[model samples]
Target: MRPSIAIAGTSNSVMARCYAWVLSNSPDFDVVNHSRGASSSTVLPYALGKIDLSQTDFLVIDVLNNEENFVLLGQTTIEDVKNNLCSALDAAAEHGVVPIVLSFPRQNFLNRERVVHDAIKAYCRELGVVFVDMYEMVEDAVERAPVTVYKRSFFDGVAHIKRPISRLVGSRLADAIRRSFHSDRVATSDHALAFDRIEFCFPEPEAGLIERQNGFATEKIACLGVGESIGLMDSFDVVGIAFNSEMTDSVLSTDHEQVISLKGPDKAEGRELMTVILPTRFRSSRLTVTGEPGAKFEFVGYARHTDDRRARTRVARRSVLPVPEFDEQFKKDIALLAVT
Candidate 1:
C-alpha cells in the first residue's frame, strides 16, 4: 500500500501545501492535507482530533513564521518556537507517527536568521526529531540567481515569497519525502522483534541495603536486573508495573506473577543508578532485600517490563542502603549539563 502521510500547518505554509501537492501527485504516497487558517498556534487542531488519522506513517509541520505581520510583531525567541513545536510533535508521536519539522523560509527583513535556525536545529536534536532546512535550500537557490535579476522574482515582499519559489521548493521537498518514505519502510521492516517476557529491576539504597561503590566513590549504587539476561542493547517489548510504597512487597517479592500492561522502551539512556523519586512527604515503607540477609526497608527500584502492552507488574520489595540523594542540587546539576 502507498504510505499514508499528513500535512499540517497554516494557510500560507507554502512548504506544507507544496508537500501535499507533491505527495498527491506521487504514485507511492496517499496524502492527507490538514493545513488550517494561518496562526501561531497549531496545538488546538491537533488536540481537537481534527488531524488524527489511523495508520498515519508520517507528518509534516511548516507553520512557524508564515503570518502576515510576523516579522513586524517582534523577534521570536527560540524557547517560544521550541515549546510549540515540541507540543505539536509530542501529540503526533502519541499516535505512533513520525514528525518532520520544516525550518522557516529565509526572509531578508529578519535580522536574527542564524539564531532562529540554530534554535530550531537544537530543539530537533534534543527531541530526536527529523528536520528539513528549507531556508538554506532556498537561500542557495537565490544566491545562484543572475546579479541583475530583481529579487521580486524570488520574493514578493520582505516576508512573503512568490510562486516560482514554491515550485522550486516543492520539487526538493517531494524528493525529501520520497527519501524519508524509503528510510521509514526499511526501519519498520528491520526492527520488528517478538518477546514473551521482559523485566527491569533497579536497586534502591537506604539503610541495611547492599552498596557498591564505583571507582570515583561519588555515588553509592545498587544493581537492577534487566530480565532474561539478554544483552543490554537488544531491543525488546515489555510490560510495566507501577508501585507505591504501600504496595511494594506484593509485586516484587514474586516471580513474574502479577504484571500490568506491556510497554516498549519510552526512552533509554546511559547506565546509571536509576532511582525512583517518590514524593518527599510520603511516609517511609519497608522492603526485603534479595541478596543481603536480614535487610528490609523503604525506597525501592521501580520495576517495569520492556514490553508494556503484554503484562502488568509492580515493585515487590524495597532495598535499604546509603545512596546519593537526587535532590534539588542534583537536579540543578543536570540542568546545567543540559544547557551546556
Candidate 2:
C-alpha cells in the first residue's frame, strides 16, 4: 500500500514526466501517471472524477507554458489563469488530495517577468497549495549556456541544448518532490501523530522474538497503512525504518521490513503502530494493529501478489499473522479510546 500519487499536466511537460519517473521508481509510491494533452482543460475532467482522484495523495499541476502562452498571445489574461487555477485547486480539495502547483519553467527566449509563471505562483500562494519554483533551476541552466555553446562549437544548432536543459529541469523537479514528501508539513497531523523513531526486524527462529539483527538483504520493504476508520484514502505517509539484520553484509537494505511508530494526538498518550512485512515472493504485505478485549492487542495480516510467474512458482500460500479477534462492543470501546 504505497502512497498513491497523481501527476497532471501537458503531454510534453518535462516536470510531469520527471515527477512520474521518480515516483515510479520510489519504493514508497504507487504512482498513477496522468497526462492530458493541450486539447483538454485542467479543471474539468479532474473534477468530474474521470481521473482516479481518490488514489492521488500528491497532485502536481504544471501550467506554466500553457498559461503563459494564453496570456502573452492574448488568448487569455492573468485573471483568467488565476481563475482557472482557483477552480482546479477547489476541485482537488473536493477530492481530498493535496495539490501542488509548479511554477512554469523559465524559457530561454521568453521574458520571465512578463510570463504567467508569477501569476501561477501567486495563485498557489493564495490557495495554500505547495508552490515549487522551477524558475530558479531554469535560470541557472540559462546562465551556463555560454559554456555549453562554446563546447558544442556550433552556434546555429540549438538542438543539443534541449538535452541539458531537460535534465536540469527534470532533476530539480524530482528533488523538489523528494523534499516535499519528507517535509515537516507532511509528517505532522492535525491531531498529534508525530513519529519519533522507527525500526524493523525479521521474526527470529523463536516465535514472538524478532531478531535484534536485520532481515534478508535482497528484500526491500516500505510500509503503508491507514486506520480502518479514516475515510481519507490517501491518509498515510511512508516512514523510513532502520533495521539490523544478520542476512546481509550491509547493515541496511532498501528491501526490508517497514516499521512505523504512531504518535498519539495532543490529548492521547499511547502510540498506535503498524508494520509492512516484505516477504521475498509477494508484491507487498501489510500488518495492521488491532486491540483485544481488555488490554491485549495483536497484528493482523494482508498480502498482495502480482502475476509474476516466477514468484507464484517459488512462493506457496501466504501466511496470516496471529491477530486478536474482538467482538463488536469491545471493538467499539477500543475505537472510542483511540485518538482522532
Candidate 3:
C-alpha cells in the first residue's frame, strides 16, 4: 500500500506554497495538509490535536520556524516550544505515526541560540525520527544557480517560498519517507519503541509488586498458540467505542508501575502476549499487553513491528568477480617500501 503523510506546518507558507504544491503532483503519496497561516509554535499542540492520526502514516512538522513573528514577539519560549513539540511526539508514537521534521530553509531570524531546532534534532536522533535537512537541499539549489537565486529571489515576497523550491524539498522529503518505511530503525533499550518496532523482554513477576489498573494486569508470556491474535489500542485516545471485550476493567500502566505493584496473579496461563506502545519525545511510556478471551495462551516477551526486519535487510547481491591473489613470486621484488 502507498504510505501516507500529513503536513503540520505553520505560517510563512512554506508547506502551503512549496511542499504541499509539489507533493500534490506525486502519485506515490496521499498528503493531508493541516497548515494554518499566522500560527506559531505555541499553537502546535492544538494544531496537532486537530489531525486525525488514524489512516495517517507520517507527520511532517517544520523546524527553524519563523523567528521574527513568533519567537521574538514572545508567543512562546524555547523551553515551552520543546515541551509542546515533545507532547505532540508522544501522541504521534501512540498511533504508530512517523514524524519527519523538515529543517527551516534559512535562519531568517535568530532567537535564543536557535535552541528550537537543536532540541528537535536531539530528540529526533534519540528517538530515531527521520529528519530531512533543508539547508543542504537549499544550498545545493543556490550553488547550482547562484545568479537566479539572488536575482529573482527563491521566495515570493515576505515569506512564501516559490513553488519550484518547495517541489524540490517535497521530492527529497518524499524519498526520505519512502526509505524510512522500508528500513528498520533501532531502539536502544528493551523498554524502547521506534516507528519501526517496539520490543521488551518480559519481566519476572514478584510476590507483591504486580500493579493493576482497573483490575487488569499484564503478565509475562512463554509462548503463543494457534488461533491467537494480537492488536493495539490507545486508551487515552479511543473511548466509548467497544473495541474488544478484554479491555473491561483494563488499565494502562507502565513497567515501573507494574513491577512495583504489591502482588502478581497466581497464573498467566490463559492470557496471550499483547503489547501496546506510545513513544514520547524523550522515550515512550510503559506498555501493557492482554490476550483474547477463550484463547489457550500465556503471555511472554512482547514485540510489535511495522515491517519485517529481515525483509528490510534483504540486500541484492552484486556478482563479484574473482580477484587473483598476489604472491612474492608474482611481485618479484619489484615493489619496495622506499620513499624514492
Per-prediction backbone clash count:
33, 9, 8
Q: State each model's CA lDDT, in order.
A: 0.39, 0.35, 0.42
Q: Model 3: per-residue lDDT, tens digit, 1-340?
A: 7877677665433344466666656788887765543344433443454467777777777634553334555533554454445555666665666666665544353212555566667755665555554444444444454133441244445445555555545665666566655655412221132222222223244312222222222333333233423333222211001111221223333434431111122224454222221112111233333334433323322222223121111111112211112233312211121001
Q: Which candidate order results from sorting by TM-score in descending order?
A: 3, 1, 2
Every model's TM-score: 0.46, 0.43, 0.48
Model 1 earns a TM-score of: 0.46
Q: Write the residue-wise lDDT of candidate 1 on 230-274 in tens digits.
A: 111123321112122221222123222322221111223432222
After superposition, candidate 2 runs with Cα above 4 Å error: 14-19, 39-48, 106-109, 112-115, 142-179, 182-340
Compose the digit string of candidate 2's lDDT tens values, residues 1-340.
Answer: 3445666654333233244455466676666544432311232223223357655656666555455554555544564344344444444554555666655442432433655776556544543456665444333333444233222221113211233333333444455555555544332112111111111132223224221211211222222223211111122222212211111111111123433332211221232222212111111233332232221212212111111112010100102211112334422332222211
Ranking by lDDT: 3, 1, 2
Better of 2 and 3 by lDDT: 3
- Among all candidates shown, the one with the greatest TM-score: 3
Worst 10 residues of 2 by lDDT: 309-318
